[model samples]
Target: MIRVLAFDVFGTVVDWRSSIIGELEQFGKSQGLQRDWGAFADSWRGGYVPAMNQVRRGELPWTRLDDLHRRILDELLREAGIQADEDDVDHLNRAWHRLAPWPDAVAGLHRLKERFTITTLSNGNVSLLTEMAKRAGLPWDCVLSAEIFGHYKPDPEAYLGCADIMDVAPDELMLVAAHPSDLRAARDAGLRTAYVDRPLEWGQPGRYRVPFEADEFDSIATDLLDLADKL
Candidate 1:
């Protein structure tokens, strides 16, 4: 029986695109800036995994997600032609720390917490997750991250590490995620899995291939609320 349900935050627990673009829109309007923030948002996001990958591979010094985001934020600010001062840009860059949880995320998590020990297992740094929990009222029993293990997802250590640190057998820990590759890694590491469909994660609704299925996981659901019901 599963006692814990660890979440993969970005697209799974919160909607990064809408959160980022919405903040960018507000900031842009406040500053009277003229630029396409969506492309900037996309480009900024494009830098994230690679940044962590470099640190994980030892190609670069160890850096947290906030630092990696700040690095990319500076790079993209010039690209987006946002002429804010350093302090303004720095404040804006930390917006990820304040992203809004998905419409169903907070309530769904609250419901799940009644039955399961819920935690976050994401590439996001601990400080990022903590600040987000404060901002969005996430009810996590504990927060786990790549920062804790000094490794990112798809690494067996990061997957198995979660199970080990939590003192649970792989079968007792279920990874609830929207990303296929992350779930695949967790499965290969012997953990149970649930694929929560988050087709709107990329933002802008559209038809696309279902990249994973029930065969890839122990269970699948349309959303966290549905996942909670199935479990």
Candidate 2:
């Protein structure tokens, strides 16, 4: 039986792309700048994995996701020749903390919470996830993150560590994620998998949807509500 449900936060539970784009647009307006904020948001998110890989490969010491995001933002700003004060930049960097949840996220989480212990299993740091949950009204029984385990998802240690910390066997913990790569890694680590589709996660129709084989995941749902039903 699945006693715990661990959610992947960024694209799955919260709509990061749209939220970031909105934040970038506000920042651009404040700076009297005109640029493709959509592309800027995409570029900022695009840097996430590579930044994490740097730590995974021992090129950098373990850094929180917030710091990684700032590093990427600094590089992007330099590349775009956009200059802003430290306070403004810091506020903008915190856009991730203020991301809005998907339409079904809060309600669906409440629904699922009735049946299982719900927590975050994300690469975001503890403070980041906590603030996000607070801002977005995400109903999490607890918050867990890469910072806690000193590893990121797709790493066996991260997956196994979640199960360990929850005091559950891998099979008893279900990893509900929108990313196939994350789900696959959890499955490989002996956890059950649930794929929640977020077709607009990249902010375009069918642009970045990952294809998966039938039966690849233990459960597949159109959204968190459907995931609750499936469970």
Candidate 3:
């Protein structure tokens, strides 16, 4: 039986692209600047993996997602020739903490939590995830993050560390994620895997694709609510 349901936060539970774009739109309107914030959000997210890889490869020190987001925000602003003061930049960088959950996230999680221990197993920093949970009203029993493991997702440590933290065997834990690579990693670590189809995770129709193979995940559902139903 699955004793714990560990979720991937950003795209899996919350709609980061839409949330980030909403914040960017508000900030742009406040500053009388107009740009394709969707593209801007995409560009900012494009830096995420490479930044984490830098730390993973030992080229850079272990940095929290908050710092990485800020660093990427600064670089993006420079590259786009967007002018803003330090205060503006800092405030804008914090938009990650204010992301909104997907329509089914809270309700589905509540349903799943009735039967299993539900927590976060995300690459986000603890403080960032905590703030986001509060802002988004996410009802996570515990918020676990890469900060605790010193490794990002797809890293064996991050996956196994979550099971360790919950004091459960890897098989007793089920990782529910939108990304197949994340699910594959958890599966490789001996955890059950459930794929939640997040069709618009990248803010475009064609950006996300569910794996065709039925064996790719232990369970696959159209959304978290559907996953809850399947469970």
> What lDDT does the true structure give each of the candidates?
0.86, 0.94, 0.91
| Top-down TM-score ranking | 2, 3, 1
- Tell me which of candidates 1 and 3 scores higher on TM-score: 3
Taking the tens digit of each residue's C-alpha lDDT, what string does model 3 give over 118-166? 9999999998899999988899999999999999888999989999999
Error of 1 at 126 (Å): 0.6
What digit string (tens of lDDT, one per residue) describes model 1 on residues 1-231?
Answer: 998888999988898888899888888988987678888888889898888888879898878888999988887877666678777777788889888888889989999999999999998999999999998999999999988998888788887888888889888999999888889889999889998888887766632325665587999888888887998
- Runs of candidate 3 with Cα error greater than 4 angstroms are 210-212
Ranking by lDDT: 2, 3, 1
Show the lowest summed lDDT stretch of 10 residues, model 3: 203-212
Evaluation by TM-score, superior candidate among 2 and 3 = 2
Pairs of residues at least 3 apart in sequence or in different chains that clash in candidate 2: none
| lDDT (Cα, 0-100) at 230 in candidate 3 | 97
Local accuracy of candidate 2 as per-residue lDDT tens digits, 1-231: 999999999999999999999999999999999999999999999999999999988899999999999999999999999999999999999999999999999999999999999999999999999999988789899999989999887889998999999999999999999999999999999999999989899987777888999899999999999998988
